[model samples]
Target: MHEKLTIDIETTGLSNQDEILQLSVLDTMTDEVLFNSFLKPSHIKAWDEATKTHHITPEMVVNAPTINQIRDAVQKLLDKASLIVGYNHLNFDNRFLTKAGFRLPERQYDVMLKYSEYIKEPNKYPEGFNKTPYKWFKLVDCATNLGYDWESRPHDSASDARATSWCYRKLAEIN
Candidate 1:
């Protein structure tokens, strides 16, 4: 019941200045990730491995919306969010946002790092689900635990955002 907005960003490069391929977010109540978009790259040479992992071709993004365009649409989503959660934002995504020249409004919580301790503590979950056994529980783990199946593949911003929402809701329910 945490009003958390879980996000996932697929970018052309590792830095904030890099072009963003896609972005998605989910409000914590529903299983669906409500917001997602594919953005056109400002730079012609966005990386390949990053593209491969995300399964987004340059052509697909070439005609896609501009970063500023998508950002305008996403502003509403970001405004509604009480918490901003992602897989690794402090070092990566947030840095990218800084480079993007927009201040991502302060997030109430960073649930990704927080859940490490949630699962690590034996009492955080039911008996036998110990730290070693479930040492690492990503968003999919949370989805599976809560009876929401992860339908899409990973790396892409939309799927990753959906999975992240699932993971967050599960852990939030527990604690």
Candidate 2:
């Protein structure tokens, strides 16, 4: 296992070029939180249903830092990692990140779709791997099966990223 940072980002909607509302990162190897911050959205077109999902209103994002500032803050953490893990990072998070003007040097390791193909039986061997092209997996489902009581709550990136890291660590041990 590499020195990994489990990460998640809460944004205004779907585009990194858009506005990043919050960020959460954890170094699984050290079990320490590396970065956690809420960003002020520079591009808030509307605070409707999309904003409701995260439960963070535009007012809350007002005091948040600029996207560039947040990116600068995480530069060290980003540079320290070779792989970044997230639930739907490949398709979603990265898009937002790129849009936010941050370039990722490390490889994107998606954990949600990656574990989706593995059988869950105690003695079951990992099968149906090649059937899916996904590399990451859903932390909620995986964590629950792994006996973790932590549930994903809205707008809590740190907790969610750490939980996902925990799920991955536990899975790696099993393998």
Candidate 3:
């Protein structure tokens, strides 16, 4: 079987232009943590809201290795995966990786998208016919709702990565 990996990243902001502060990748099939690191930012300032969400401060990353310093290793891990998965990765993590100069694997999966599709509710229309509606879900909220025991705090890269894996497994079982 082809290798499967799950990845998660914590950043300084929400936009693609934001700097990545932490990243985690896990080999899902093997249950091995392939890469986990906190990157020191060189170009962007850490936003207060982002820090509150991820609990990563500028001081915490001050002595950490920059993205450039670990790009090679991260790329290698990504290259080895036949499928790279993440929570909201297609819309968020992938863009940041590309902006930071990392080549992502071709086969990418977004657990958030899958979960949204699985639990989608029909939109209520007061004046017209109803249609399928897509709703955004938080990783922690999804995992807990699916009955998975998610112990790590939300927004931490490693914790999010693990939660993504749990979500993937649960999704697979249902399908």
Candidate 4:
């Protein structure tokens, strides 16, 4: 009976060199926000393109705590949970966390991957051919499909974590 945690991150960019600007995690069973913060990057300035997508500006994070400052607390949260869940954590969020030097738990579930696999139309392809790859869906779209209304902004990490938890529960109920 281990705890399940849901996480989401807002970053400077999509590349490996990019930094995490914000991180949020929630306890899935209790819907409690375990950790959330805006991180100040030590290097790599200018996130114009990423800013356009997440709307987190340099000014917003200028005085925020650096990832190192919060490392211990973040690690404690990570260590407490045996299962980590996120919308696109496998391909996206986890990379940013690892790049920032956090040791993650081995057990993780990607809600995006689950939903992608769940709704896949394998029969649409030829019988002899390999099934098409699972298509990724946006977090907002998953929320919409699950009929979950968001209480906060979309791109914000905390809100996304909440939405991910909501969608995960809905997906679990049916599956």
Estimate the TM-score of every prediction: 0.75, 0.80, 0.90, 0.91
Error of 4 at 36 (Å): 1.0
Query: Model 4 residue 6 lDDT?
Result: 91
Candidate with top lDDT is: 4
Question: Which pairs of residues collide in model 1?
Answer: 16-96
In candidate 3, what are the lDDT values of residues 1-175, reduced to their tens digit? 3389998999999876689999898986555788899999888865788988889998899899999999998888877779998998888888889998998889988998889889884445534521336666788889999997868688889888988988998899999
lDDT of 4 at 167: 88
For candidate 4, report its TM-score.
Answer: 0.91
Evaluation by TM-score, superior candidate among 1 and 2: 2
- lDDT value for candidate 4? 0.87
Per-model CA lDDT versus the true structure: 0.67, 0.70, 0.85, 0.87
Q: Rank the candidates by lDDT, best first.
A: 4, 3, 2, 1
lDDT, candidate 2, 1-175, per-residue tens? 3367788887767643456778888886665888888888775756576677777777777777887776786866777788888877776787887777676766766666556645432323335533344333456767777787775573578877877787677767876
Q: Which window of 10 residues has the lowest lDDT sum in candidate 4? A: 123-132
lDDT of 1 at 153: 84
Two-way lDDT contest, 1 vs 4, winner: 4
